[model samples]
Target: MQGFKKAFAEQLRLALPSQEVTLERPKDYQKGDLAFPCFKASQSLGMSPQSLASLLASKIKIKDATIEATGPYVNLRLLESVRSRETLASTLGNYPLPPQEKKNATILVEYSSPNIAKLFTIGHVRSTMLGHALANIYAQEGYEVVRLNHLGDWGTQFGTLLAAYELWAKDSNPELEKNFPWAAEYSSESTTPLHRLLQLYIRFHAEEEKNVSLREDARAWFKKLENQDPDARRLWKKFRDLSLIEFNRIYERLGVTFDSLEYGEAFYEDQIPGVLNALDSKGLLKEGENGSKVVDLSEEGFDIPCLIQKGDGTSIYASRDLAAALFRKSKWNYERCLYVAGSEQNFHFQQVFAILSKIDPWFKNKQTHVPFGLIKLPEGKMSTRKGNVIFLEDVLNEARDRIQKIISAKNPELSNQAATSEMLGTGAVIFINAFNDRNTSITFDWNKVLAFEGDTGPYVQYAHARICSIFRRAGGSWSQWAEPRSEDFGRLHFESIELPKSLQGLDHASAQHLIFELNGLEPALKASAISLSPTSLARQLLTISKAFSVFYNDSPILNVEQSEAIRQSRLLLCLATARVINQGLRWLGIFAPTEM
Candidate 1:
């Protein structure tokens, strides 16, 4: 289908050598599959749009398509047989996508930097999934992508946790130790070291209200950690290691991974001195209040300076970020580095990028902050210190439990019910996160995310499953077309069988609309990458699902009254729709189940 569009565009260009041709699909498919508006050309030619359209229509000719002039547009309608064959072949992976210019370049994406002692909350899902989707999209466009997780394993938050641990050790407070034991072993049990650290953290905050000296103690502990105190370093390493064990369990379920696990803030802590020395040598470093080092951005139109260090001689976020940026450029030489953080940190990124630009102008155009809006529950905001948070694992477990009950009621004897329920459950959560624009704040709703109908992940997955069921009812080797050997159901292989020659069964309006929607996958992917948003691709998948529903209702693929050739052709169309939906969902990091 993409090849056909390119051919049509070339034919139009040859007809109007003086103008750049622009093509669009009409709102109503009855007009044409592709339309060329002549308003701009007509103005330059000193003629009416209708007249110019007619002139171009008469001059242009495509091999398997009909060209017509309808008012100010030149519409091209593809021959039904040729359109069916081309569309099916494209969706079945017989056609190759056009070449990409960035095939030789690399992209670095950093995201999901949750703090060490906190649980993975619903608020962190936006950045994690959005960054994952964008990285997938970039790889699809032929760029070498490097996934990074700039962990929040440093700073005063760790100080508070360390202080709390020392203040309430197992020997000092037996009551607190009973609730959360400070054991050396870490496992998948409920009382892991991470959970104990979180409880200790919350208790410290709660007790700080009555004890005014706890804040000072935390600050002092952090200063010790910065000065290479052996005890402080040992505890920090323990917390960091155990946190990764807990975080990786969630990442495993979500099917996410990073290229470099060691390139976090702590990894660049020792490099901070080099950054400060370089800035001081360049005369860019300034002395701010309280002996802290800073960079004045008054000429850059900012009221406040970028703090490079604290008054206590500890390196801060700006200094560490500068070092990370410099290391990425020297190490990976990425063409673009994307930081997927929340919108609230926009100013902090701006300050870091400004400093990079002043130090080296080449860094000006290479970095981007892919900011997303917040996600909240109906009760308002969540806070880690107050212990009013929802863990991601709990939400996923709840979704899986609900799906398991629904499957037991709907398909009592279905095989692999446990695995299918998990797939559908996790896919539902991922789809809802990707369905909206990146910057649109969402109040999480369970009904919308889990609905089997409407614009939901289950709706699209069910469409693929229905197609599989069709093949199952047909019996014999039909199941092999779905790639039964692979764990991923979307790894379809339908090209082994030849499509029926009598494709006149697909001439119906509904079938044509479905084919038209299938043709849009490539363009939709391009648009999603360009805008850095998955909403376009998600909506396109929903449109394909709706179109398939219409086609399924109006046409019969296996009725005895229909001829064998027509049934085979209709079945081929069904397979094509399933394959396209599966591919789109895979790119968004969602799975398409062959059964629901």
Candidate 2:
């Protein structure tokens, strides 16, 4: 289809040698398959748009297409023969997508950096799915995509948790109480460890309000952890390991995988002294109150100092981020690195990137902070210390349970009950986050996400299942189409097949509309990939799904009034719709079910 458009554009050049011609799909199909507006050029040529359009329309002569002058535009209508089964061959291999502009280009996408002791909150879901989709889209464009989970494993918060654990949790594990007085009940079983850890964390924050000395105690324990004291190191390692096990369970359900995991703050702990010393040597580090180290940014448009290290000589986030950025450049030599964080950290990331650029002028513009909007529940924003956050795992489990009930009541005879429910539920959760623009704040609405009758994931999935049923029934009745070694049902790569003798005589408008949308997949793929938004492709898939549903209803596939040839042609259309829908859905990290 892309080649055909290019060839048609080249033909237009011959007709109007002095014109810069661009072709567009008309809003109304009756206008034309492709329309070119003559008004812009005609004004400079001192001629009316209608006259120029008519003149150009007369001069144009192409095979298997007709030209017409409609008001101020020139329209082109392709013959059925011009867009036959052979036209779809590009979608099979690599016909649709153009060659990669830069081969072996590496990109690191860092996202879903949930803290070690906290549950995976709803906000993590947004950043995680966004990064996952971007990685997939980048990979399709031939980039060496690396999905990095920059975990938040080291901070003052860990100190608070340790202090809390030492005070309240040491007695829970009597054996550990004797050997290591600070370690909590490190449950080998995954279920209770996270809950106990979060409880201790909350308790520490609540107690810190009444007892002022607890803050210093928390700071002291964190300083010990930072110094890698043997006892503190053991507990920190235990907390990190158990937390990962629970996190992986959630990620597995979402189908999100990481190529590299880095504790950015922790990974740079050793490099902190060297980095700070370099800053001092470069005259960037300055002394602050109470024996603290800071970098004055007044000249750089900041009123406060960017603290490199706290008064107690413990490194802050900025110091560690500088080390991590240099380390990544040395390790991957990546052309581009994206930090997919929340918008709440906008100023902090801005400070980090700005200071990194000032420290080394060569490191500017190569890194991006793609801060996404925060997801708010109906209640409001979440706070882990207050214990008011809605857990992502709980929401996913609820979605799965609801879908299983739907399947039981609606699709009782379906054999793949377990798999089907998961596919639908997971697809529901992913689709809502992906279909919304990344930079826009959106409320979590399970009603809209799970609706089967509207513009929702289940609606599209059912459309796929509907197409599969049509094909299955048609294949069984007409064994000729499914002859052994001649055809298969794994995937319908039917672009090269000759049009059946019966389908040659059909010219229904519904069939034409379906064909037009199918031809647009290649351009849609390029648009979605280049714009760095899967929502473009998502919206396109939804368009195709809705169109197919309309076509199926208007044109009967197995009605007694229709001939066998008509039935075959409609079935062929159904196959084409299913292929594009399935392919497009997968591109957006959605699963299309064969049966709902």
Candidate 3:
């Protein structure tokens, strides 16, 4: 597929040396699949744009492509046969994919770094799914992908937790609180560690407004924790571990995994001094208000210098990020490291990357901060302290329960109800946000997510299941058409079943459209991966689903009266659609259930 684009580009480059040759998609299919505008190139050639396009359309020789001149644009369409036998076959691995244009190298994707001490909220949905899908797409492109969950496990938050814990101990008594059912040491039978920590943290802030000294006490505790004082370290470790236990449960339920789970601020505490020393030696460190130390990124256009060290000699988040970058570089030796963070941190990252670039040139080109917009409820942005935050686990579980109830009402006898309900419900939550533009804030709407029609996750998954049902009903389905039956076809092996001789000559709008959609799988996947946006692929998958549905309605597979041969051929088409949909949804981190 890439070869076609390259060959076409080379042809145009040879004919028009001065033009920036690019193949654009026509707004309407009638204009052709790809188009090249010739207005500018025509001037150099001393001809009208339409005339130049016509000349190129006639002169450029492309096998299996029909070139047409439309106004000032030259449009081209691949012959359906080349699409069916070559592109389709390659996507199904009757042949290998065109050699990868990119060299195989490692990339580390760091996402879902929600701060510990607070439960994961509805806000994390976009980053987690976006990062997950990008990782999947990167692997599809043959990159050595490392998925890192950069847990926000360090910094002043831990200090706040320690201070709260100390206060709670004094007020409630350590012995009594320890013996309480939901204790610091979580057990297999008990829960609520996360709730306890969150309550303490929120209450500390609340009480601090009444007694200002509480804030100082919290800061002191955090400083002690940073200094690795025994009691403070022990308490900090307890908060960190218990928080992770809660986090792991959510990750497990949501089907998110990490190759590495590294603490951000705490992990870099030991190296932060050296980070400051390097900045100091290089004359990058500037004195900020009071005794604080900072990096002057004013030239990068900031009003205030980026504070690296506080007045009390404590390191801030920016300093931790700088040290973490150094740690990740030496540790993974990755070609690229993407930080999937919220869009609010855009300037913060730019400043950090700018400061790091001053200290280490290698940091500038390789590191990327992939920012996304906020996830807001219908009312507005939520806050944990205000008690308005929606728990992520609750949302996921509700999605499952609601789906299960619907299944019970609609298809009471459906097998594997528990498992199917879980997948579909979780997919609903994920799908609602999957196609949203990364920089646009999305308002959660249950009505929209659970909708049966339109581009919902259930809608796509149902299409896969519907295709599966077609094949199951067409018993002696193409799989057993051969002398010996083969196992089910996967992404790489769809060509195993030979199309019957009579079916080989199959050509109709339905067959042609289905094959076209099937052949387009690779290109859509490529575009999605390159753009680092899952919605591109998500939108493409929806197109394939709608196209397959049209083909399903217009073309008869098992019920056709013509002959068994044509029936089998249509069955092959159905199998191909199911395979593509299943694989595509998997890449999107959504399920394509075999049975709806």
Tally clashes: model 2.
0
Worst 10 residues of 2 by lDDT: 482-491
What is candidate 3's lDDT per residue for 390-442, written digit by digit as tens?
Answer: 67777777788888988899889899998898889888888777777788887
TM agreement with the true structure for every prediction: 0.93, 0.86, 0.89
- Report, for every candidate in turn, its global Cα lDDT versus the true structure: 0.82, 0.73, 0.74
| Candidates in order: C-alpha RMSD to true structure | 3.4, 5.2, 4.4
Clashes of each: 0, 0, 0
Clashes of 3: 0
TM-score, candidate 2, is 0.86
Residues 55-160, model 2: lDDT tens digits: 9889887777888899999888777645545443443332223334656888888888888888887678888877777776677677788788878788788888
State the displacement of the C-alpha of residue 403, model 1, in Å, after optimal TM-score superposition.
Answer: 1.1
* Window of ten residues with lowest summed lDDT in model 1: 484-493
Scored by lDDT, the top model is 1
Candidate 1 residue-wise lDDT at 340: 94
